[model samples]
Target chain A: MFLRIDHVGIACHDLEAKIAFFESTFGMTVVSREVNEEQGVREAMLHVADGPNGSSYIQLLEPLSPDSPVGKFLAKRGEGVHHVAFGVPDVAEAMGELGGKGIRLLDERPRHGSMGSSIAFLHPKDVGGMLTELVQAPPPRT
Target chain B: MFLRIDHVGIACHDLEAKIAFFESTFGMTVVSREVNEEQGVREAMLHVADGPNGSSYIQLLEPLSPDSPVGKFLAKRGEGVHHVAFGVPDVAEAMGELGGKGIRLLDERPRHGSMGSSIAFLHPKDVGGMLTELVQAPPPRT
Candidate 1:
């Protein structure tokens, strides 16, 4: 049902400092940056490596407001892996399939995600402890 | 230094049930399973997807003893992501490089990990509240 790991979203209190640490310490590179108002996050995608399907990323997320999801995550759990997104062909289909199996979804339908992707989240409680995301990338530009 | 995410290790109280969850819900398949005495955990690597570099996995770890590291994690934080392992060409070199950057090391030297890999862990405190592992996979059989 899934393709590969799209990205690992990390909740960061200080996105700049954390990005620097990943770059200087781990030698990772930043491929893209965006501020998603709907998601209430200022995020950057750090390139982990290149491969056949596509490049994987370590996504650093800093909430724009304290009431946002990432903000709440940092307030409760501090800095850590927030969620893991698996690449899917269709986010809506994946959501429907999982929901049919008694899984709780945070999003009723696909929502806009970073890099023109459609995404929906599964409830962490129902996922056995980890917040899971289903991401479907937009078709390649002609 | 790091090539790609080797696996995301998740702490589970019941490995059987969790593996079943991934299989039934996400359609992930178990690629490998192992019991590591030194790590004090029974682990199974579930295939997330395949790529040029290799396949990524969601590793489920169940502590053999309550006193083990995974056990302590479950007791304190409940079931969730235990650690994220990054693939590297040389475990010792990666350890030395990170150590030189003042990042504390949980293992002074590479030790046996699940599936005959050389692995060393980084201190979670220094790593922004998430345990990190550097993994050097065994060479391909000739």
Candidate 2:
């Protein structure tokens, strides 16, 4: 049902500081950045150089609004991993299967994620105690 | 220098129950199990299916004694991801680079990890609040 890790979400009070730390220390390069007006935050992605198996990304997130989810997370937990995302072959199919098991879905349908990927979130309460996200890559061009 | 994800460690109060959850929900199989007396815990690994470029594993760790690190982690954070381990090409080189950045290392040298992999840990304080582990597979046979 799952492919590989799409990215790990990190909530940060200072996104630039975190991004600088990874880039300076590990040589991770920023791949993309975007702002989600609806979510009220901005995100940046850093792809690992020579990453495992040719796939891996680090996501740095900062809340644009004080009341956003990332904002609250940063206020309470400080800078740290916000969630782990697993790459799913098909987001809709995976969500349907999880829904059958009484798992709570954060997104009823696939939504846009960093770097043009489609993603859906699953509540951590249903997935043991770890927050998990389901991500499906956009189909390759023919 | 990383190759792939070795495993995501989850600290659990009921190791068996958590192990069962992944097994039943995702059909994960245990590839290895062990007890690290120094860390004071018994560990069970669940192999992730269709991993990126290679295999991925979920490590469920239960404290052996109440005074163990796993036990203390559980008391403080409840059940969730304790750390993320990435398979590196050279554990020593990675540690040295990280150390140069004043990163606080949990282990000064590479220690034995499950499946004969050499591993070192970085303190969360030095890594933006998320524990990180660097692992290197044993050198290939001649």
User: TM-scores of all models?
Assistant: 0.97, 0.92
Q: Which DockQ value does candidate 1 get?
A: 0.75
DockQ, every prediction: 0.75, 0.46
Q: Which regions of candidate 1 fall more than 4 Å away from where they truly are?
A: none
Candidate 1 lDDT at B87 equals: 87
lDDT of 2 by residue, A1-142 (tens): 6556667787887778888988887777898889988667798988743323235677888999778998998888788888888877788888998888778999879888776778888888777677888887777678
- State, as a TM-score between 0 and 1, how close model 1 is to the true structure: 0.97
lDDT by residue for model 1 (B1-142), tens: 8777888999999999999988998888998889998889999999876666555789999999999999999999999889998889899999998999999999989999767789999988787677889988888789
TM-score of chain B of each: 0.95, 0.90
lDDT over C-alpha atoms for residue B12 of model 2: 85
lDDT top scorer? 1
The per-prediction tally of clashing pairs is: 0, 1
